[model samples]
Structures are given as structure tokens and as C-alpha cells.
Target: MRGTIQNRDEFLSKVAGQLGQRSFTEGVERPKWKYQPQHAVLKDAGSDELLEILKMQCTKIHTDFFVSGKSGLMETLKTVVSNYGGGPILTWKDSRFDTIGLTPLFKQIWPEENVEINEWESSRGEENIELAEKANVGITISDITLAESGTAVLFSSKDRGRTVSFLPAKSVILIPKSTIVPRMTQATKIMREKVKNGEHVASCINFITGPSNSADIESRLVVGVHGPTKATYIVIEDL
Candidate 1:
């Protein structure tokens, strides 16, 4: 049996020799495909029109969309928290949130209560993860939102961890109207520029379209199996 198997070595060697002699393309330039601009439809669309389209698309996918101005942002956030039944909220510690002055509002709502409010900290990774797992609501600020698909783009980093959006039962995202684009190509172009400028882009860039849903078992739908069951987007109109 050993001698018979060894006989196949010659055949394997012949195959290898034949493969080695094959010529492969070298430095061959292929013509690139040309297509119409993807976001041309949005070029003439006003901000109000874009916002309406985004809101419609987001609602179609079961995401609650709230519109507010810079002055009304805190009030909108408070209303969102109250609607979610308040307390046990997890959020990122990014300065954009600080500029929005959420800390005082959170403290006012859940003052001195242990485990009621947890902010992402670079030094307290394990604690933050535990808080995220148990939190009723998680809040994040999105880098961009795509109007065509109603998708929000989040870039995770030390300031904003991935679990803050994925581990909670309900997730809330704050997006500026100025950052809303017509399609994904524009959003990705902006992200590419950020990466090129030596910004600290994280290994994970999340593009969340809607709540986590699965229809794999028995054609019945289940929500929040892998992530948040519900998502709410607050679009700041006057940012």
C-alpha cells in the first residue's frame, strides 16, 4: 500500500511542473467601469427634503426618528429618556456629548444613584461592559447618516466603544443634519478623508440600518437577539 501511494508522487510532480510553466498576467491594466454619479439626485434636494426622506426611510425600517434644533436637543433627550422609563443609561464620553451638556441633565435625572448612569471610560473597561449589558438605554453620536438607506455610521474608539450601541436593550443615536448625506458613497468618502488625515479610526465601523431582527427560525421574527431591540435617532436640525 505504501509503494502504491508513492507512485502518485510522479503524477503530482508532473502537475506542479505544468502549473509552473503557465503564464500569468503581469502589470496588466484593466479598464475601469464608468457609471453615473450615485448621489446626483440629492444635489438639487434641499435640507428639508433630505430630512423628510431620511425620516420616512427610517420609519419604514421601524426606527423612531426625532427632529430637534440645537436649543431643543436637551429637551428631546429628556423626553426620550422619560419615554424609555428613565435610569440605567449608558453613553459615550465623547466631547461632542459634553458640548451638548448631557452630563448635568443625566445627573439631574439620576443623581447619586449607583448603576443608573454609566459613561464610557478608557480606564474602566470591564465596569463599562457590565453597565452596558444591564443598561436599559444606550446613547451614541453618529459620524454620519445615509439618507438613501437610513443607515447611521459609528466609528468606535476609546471614547466611544462598540458595546455601547450593541449591548443595550434600546439604543439612541444623535446625528447632525449637516452630516446626513444622500447615500453611502458620500459617507464613505468622508470617512476615507478622516483616515487619510491620520485620525484614529477604529478597527470596527458600524453601519446600523435598523433594530436587530432575525427570521431564521420557523419564519417567525425575533427582535434584539443579537443587538438592541429598538433604535431611536435624534436628528439635530440646527446643529
Candidate 2:
């Protein structure tokens, strides 16, 4: 016969101690992937081809375009946005990107928008949600991302919040085309590797395909949920 445990702390501590024993720590000092790198097969197009796609997608004439914390995005976005009458460009000062000295690059492109930086980040939830909902464009970075599927992976946590990507009407993504894999199978393999390496996985992983859409209510296609309606991926060349 076993005695009943009355103290909650003792029970929790016993369980936690047992669980901590199998804590993963081996092979925790490597990039998420080593053996099978993502396969990025470029689909070459004419010089104006990219522009034509943008037009066909109905990119707004004077709309905000969110820029993610990715390599080459700063320079490319400056060139691209300047050509199209730049609007708001979004970014995070996360260590993952800033440690690589990418923050300064972003500062160079469209510095005017920084006039209200503190106000933007410190805004209340209702205001933030409203901004996300009303804004026409958004951008995001990726981790353990996929290019073949034209998908961008974003983990909403801490400073890198979810509303930045979801509430917007249209969202754009910047990904290193080299990180594009052929299938989900390969993607998961890399994820497993990251875990084995003792990397801290994000609390929430957002796999954005094209954009936010639904066919609810008599099959009437409706874009924009509590999320974006149109989403596009601008695959950046691997440096």
C-alpha cells in the first residue's frame, strides 16, 4: 500500500526532478541543419518578371510593406520600396538577427519611419491589433523555414509578437531561397535536428503559405481573417 501525498510542492518537485534527468544537452552547438541542407531551386525569370508578378498580385500603389529581419532585406527593400514609393517598413531588434550586424543595415533604409519607433512598440494591445488589422502589408523572417512551399516560419513570442504578421491585410516574406526544401518531410528532419542540438524552439511556430484566406459562408472566398488576406514571399538570394 502507498501513502497519499498531501503537499503539492513535494509532488511537483518529485515529478520535475524525474523529468529533468532526461534533459537534452548533447550535440547542442550546431546550426539547425547540417546533413541535409534545404534545396533551393531558382526559377529564373525575365528582368521585369518579378515586377509583373507584383503588379498581378495587386501590390498597393501607396501601401505599407513589412520588412523582416533577414539578410539582404535592408538593401533590397530600400531599392524595391524606394522604387515603389516606400511605406512603413517593420523589423525587430532580436539578437538572432542583430548579433549578425543586420540592425544597422535596416536603419539605412527609410530612416524617416523611425520617427515614432517608441510609440509603435509601446502601443496598447487594442491599438496594436487595430494597426495590424488596418495595415495592408506585413513582413517576417524565418527560422527552420521552407522556400519550396513559398512559406515563411515565424515564432510569435516576446518582442517578436504575432499581431505584426497576422492582423495585417497583406503580408510579405523574405527568405533565403537556399533554405527551400522539396517537402515537409525534409523540413521536419531539420526541426528534429534542432531539438537534438538542444536549441530552444519557439513557443509558437507560424507557417505562412500565401496569405490569410477562408471560404466560409456559402463558399464565398474571403481573404483576411483575424490575419492577412494576401501574402507573398520575396525569396532573397543566399549570400
Candidate 3:
């Protein structure tokens, strides 16, 4: 284990050397752009005003509603798709759950179209690319993302894949209001503390503000270019 750590450190140092000087040091000049969450207007907002602020800023609302981490997010997703009329594509962390649990949801949501409920254990190479192109919207239950920035952090693990957040026409997130924080720097501090205590850092860390958008085409705004055009966050309060 010690030798492995040494090798990893050496590899990082070599890569840093090749990359040249790093600019992120104390008391440095500011960069050209900063990521700010589109100002939102969360309904019934309180101490954390981010949700409300985001709601005000965005043009559309898309999200997975859940009461808790164990909430039936997939079922609620079915409800949205069924009522709204979007094609249903179900992906789960558990192969068995996909086999047993998803059938009823699909039957209820997509009674007309031939539903495609696919199971994937690993998201690598071609599979990742395919999932990105095929899925119009992706749903996820997250630990905590900064409400201020309108970002959702998914612990890249076996069950919750990173691509689920990126590479979709829309990305809808489910997060309890209690987990919402005021700023990204605070969240970073918390993550660093967790890492010091041996918490598993997922392969990717994402800070999403709005839909995948670009305005370069004749200065005309367009969404869903590199990623989903819209991101909706659902906040469930304790009732």
C-alpha cells in the first residue's frame, strides 16, 4: 500500500510538471469567468434561498420529487413522464431491482410506447457514450449540492453513475431542502474533511448551474448542446 501511494504521488508530480505552472494559489488574479447559479425563486423559501432563487431564474421546471434518500424517485419519475409524455428509459444500480421493480412503473407510465428498461452495471467507454446520446432526461438522488450555485453532487459509485447527471437533454435532481448549502466553498471544505476521514470520492465531481446551453450561433441562445438544456431540482421539506 505504501509503495502504491508513492507511485501515485510520483505519477501526479510528473503530470503536474508536464502541465506547467498551476494558477490556483492564494492571493492570485481572478479568472475570466465564474460559475454563478442563475438567480432563482424557490417557493416558500427560508434560510437557504437558493431553490426559490433558481426557480425564478429558469424558464422550465424539471426534477425528481422525493421525501428522502430512500424515496420512490423512480416511481415519481414515471408519474412525470406519463403525465408529460416523454419516452421512458429506466436505468438502475441494482440489476435485480431493474428486473423486478421497474416493470410496474413502466407499465403505468408508458402504456402506449414500447418501453425500454435497460440494466447497466458498469458505465465505461461505448456504453457511456451510448447512454449520453440516447437518454433525453436523467434523474438522480444526490447527497448535497450547493443551492447557491444550483449544483448537484453525485458520489460516483456503482449505483449512481456520473453520466446520469451529464449527457442528457434534461437533468432532474431530487434533494431534501435540509441538505442545501449556501456556497460552493463550504461544500468543498466538507468534501475535503470527508476525504481526510477516508470517504470514497466518486470518479467525477459536477457543479451544474443551468441547462447545457450555448449562444454562439449568431448570438442566438440554444440549450442542450453539450449536455441537457435544463436542470430542475426538487426540494422536499419535512412535513
lDDT of each: 0.83, 0.52, 0.57
Per residue, candidate 2 scores C-alpha lDDT tens digits across 132-232 of: 55554555666544433445577666566676677655565655444555445557777788899998777677876666666776987666655655555
- Model 2 clash pairs are 28-197, 224-229
In model 3, where do residues sit more than 4 Å from their true spots?
1-50, 57-76, 90-114, 123-125, 217-219
Q: Choose the strongest candidate by lDDT.
A: 1
Candidate 3: 10-residue stretch with minimal lDDT = 61-70
Cα lDDT tens digits for candidate 3, 1-239 = 22334576567667777899443325756475565433233323564466554444343323333332324545665555544346435343643334334445544545555655443347454675476568766656556756545666666666656777777666666566666765566577679888989987766766666667677859877767787766666555541
**What is candidate 1's CA lDDT for residue 94?**
86
Query: What's every prediction's RMSD, in angstroms?
Result: 8.3, 10.1, 7.8
lDDT of 1 by residue, 26-129 (tens): 57465765865775768777778888889999877789989988888888987887788776899898888767666666666566544378789989968889
Quote model 1's TM-score.
0.81
TM-score for predicted model 2 compared with the true structure = 0.56
How do the candidates rank by lDDT, highest first?
1, 3, 2
Q: What is candidate 3's TM-score against the reference?
A: 0.61
Model 1 lDDT at residue 68: 87
Better of 2 and 3 by lDDT: 3
